[model samples]
Target: MASKNRKPPRVGDQPGFRRALIAAVLVVTAIFIVAPLVVIGVQAFSQGWAVYATAIADPDTLHAILLTVTTALIAVPINTAFGVAAAWAITKFDFWGRRFLLVVIEIPFSISPIVAGVAYLFVYGLQGLFGPALQSADIKILFALPGIVLASMFVTAPFVARELIPLMQAQGRDLEEAATSLGASGWRTFFSVTLPNIRWALLYGVVLCNARVMGEFGAVSVVSGNIRGQTNTLPLHIELLYHDYQTAGAFAAASILAVLAVVTLVAKVLLERRGAGRGGRPTLAANQTVPETTT
Candidate 1:
């Protein structure tokens, strides 16, 4: 009775040992994560605003940015559609080799990006199987835009499906069944019943995938040929600038990628927080939308 009547402990009331542990963690995080970010920000603007602006505004830099964005545009949409389809199929049905398929989808996560690029080269390079025929037709795959897009797709393919499959599986087919029984067509069922339930998670995966696509270096590097303004993406451009003794320019280019990382982190945090809320609503309704349904 006496304990129940006492006030609950506050954050500041943590034991000395616990507080010390937390402090240690904060210090380590600041030293590793925060310090690098600060260095990037400082070095990016180190040469003054005019120089920084000029560096980013350079024709080559602009082209690099455009190429990077274009790659994302091409890769993300295809991956998104594929992800939805794969997730639906994998989670809603049972089949032979389903586990094997899941493992195959997750291959990109385990392999190095550099190795992926090499594989692309061997398959599409001059001496490769289809290379001779493609070369005869003047169709380029290696060290070209197509190669870059393919690499990006290969690297980012699993993200969205990975996010959605487990979630859809957990949700079961109850809502989808309900919708179908109520006269919803297959398309209608997905749009009205399935989509709303997992939109946040889908978006989260897409955001992550986009970040990876934009920042992809190793695979793109092998396939891009580092053609000054033609195939060079932002990361490759950064390397170009640095090697050319353009210190400020390199950092300036890096800043854009850094900002993208920060934005992604922020979105992830916001979504997670919303997913955790539960005030006067269904527990999943905290920051979540209408109840989720499986495919």
Candidate 2:
């Protein structure tokens, strides 16, 4: 008798088991990430826009929104610049203490935001170590706009750098050298070569940084003094509304932030997909073909 042969197992051979396991994991993860957002949305629309209108109508809430957007607009750019510079320094060049410097960049992430706030207070608050000097020069930091911006910058600084370092390292310096050899100036090479390579990572980092800056509460709360219409940010304003027994108003404000977060997440996914498509496409020239430069 001839020996019988058996077919190789396909991925779907164990379909029922695999499907059950995947379903369980997906359901759990979805609940973990989305349950709170659903609750907030339900609360926001439960009263048929009356609560949302009331929340938005409040002058204090309006001021907080303005302050939050303004601070994020200012701080995100500063952090992006810093992140790019830091990534360049760490990846493109070798230097003494470079390892130590990279470690220092992560300090803000490890330290509690409350601790960061308190540390800033020690340096900039009235009666702080630098208080006399600032007062003498008529400069204010604690309980002021500068303090809010500074705290936000500190918290969000690492996001871009962390995203860029690995990307820059993996990309290497080949394109940059090729551009330089082809009569491109250093600035031109950077803009034409380096920027395009890391643009997606940079944009993703900015989105995350902006989200964190907008949602930050502990650190900003400590320094902001929660002064209504003046120092209050959207997150702080939400807290105030919650404390004032305005549950619907609190959820309404929070729902706006949740919506923004969702929008940012969607944009990030689309951009990442675009980046992936670009990355997957073959370059016009393997040696040194100048591709169409993107602005």
Candidate 3:
């Protein structure tokens, strides 16, 4: 009885209510997160390994996968370039309408992708302003691969740019000025200094943007017309299969996307851990201060 009295309360102790609360939260997360993942994995292979392989290997499925990959490959690089250039201009050299440009860049995150899709359709469709000229020139923007790419670009336009804005702002222009003072060319300074400093943040944005580009449904759907083995992306193809009552095939196709999401999550975790180990976020320059780190 004396020893029990001297002992401190542990998680399993009678008075340890916090532990129980934590356990409940964790259980809730697992139910919503882990359980769904398990379901997708199981259903993906419900028809056995051989059938799952066939589902994934189907010609339409393969085409969808290729188009998705192509979209990301094109969109990611284009966005990366734009993000860097925008971040540089906004942070390094302030001009008229800087804040306004920032607001414009963030519009994508605030609005629904569906709205973006509809807006693009109106702008690029056969009845749009440029539609007549494009058709006269034998150019097809809507209901084709080019439309898919453009829609992706529209929705993912903001990611990398936004990620680098705060980072570059915090970094200030000290390094760039120093490099210039030392007679470094603009191109050299940018390649040698700015790129290295914001590499991680840039990568973080790119990974996220690419993930969205590959997974985009609504915008791509509006432009792609869901043509089987042609404009159909992975998400659309999955829907096509599901609509045809091919549950197994649909789930199998979905598994690839699920795996990609998991991989992206893991990469984000690694980047976070790496940043932490390196003392985390950089100090905001004297001109500006970084926001307080949040969980």
Give the top-scoring candidate (lDDT): 1
User: What are the lDDT scores of the predictions, listed in order?
Assistant: 0.85, 0.81, 0.83
Pairs that collide in candidate 2 are: none
Tell me the TM-score of model 1: 0.88
Tens digits of per-residue lDDT for model 3 on 55-124?
A: 9999999999999999898889999999899888888875767766776776776667788888877888
- Lowest-scoring 10 consecutive residues by lDDT in candidate 2? 281-290
Q: Cα deviation in Å at residue 237, candidate 3?
A: 0.7
lDDT of 2 at 256: 79
- Select the stronger candidate by TM-score from 1 and 2: 1
Regions more than 4 Å wrong, model 2: 1-13, 181-183, 275-295
- Number of clashing pairs per prediction, in order: 0, 0, 0
Please write out the lDDT profile of model 2 over residues 48-94, one tens digit for every residue. Answer: 87667987888988899999999999899999999999978776776
- Candidate 3 — worst ten consecutive residues by lDDT sum? 280-289
Residue 232 miss distance in model 3 (angstroms): 0.4
Q: Which prediction has more favorable lDDT, 1 or 2?
A: 1
Q: What's the true lDDT of residue 97 in model 2?
A: 70
Query: lDDT per residue, candidate 1, 75-96, as tens digits?
Result: 9999999999988887777777
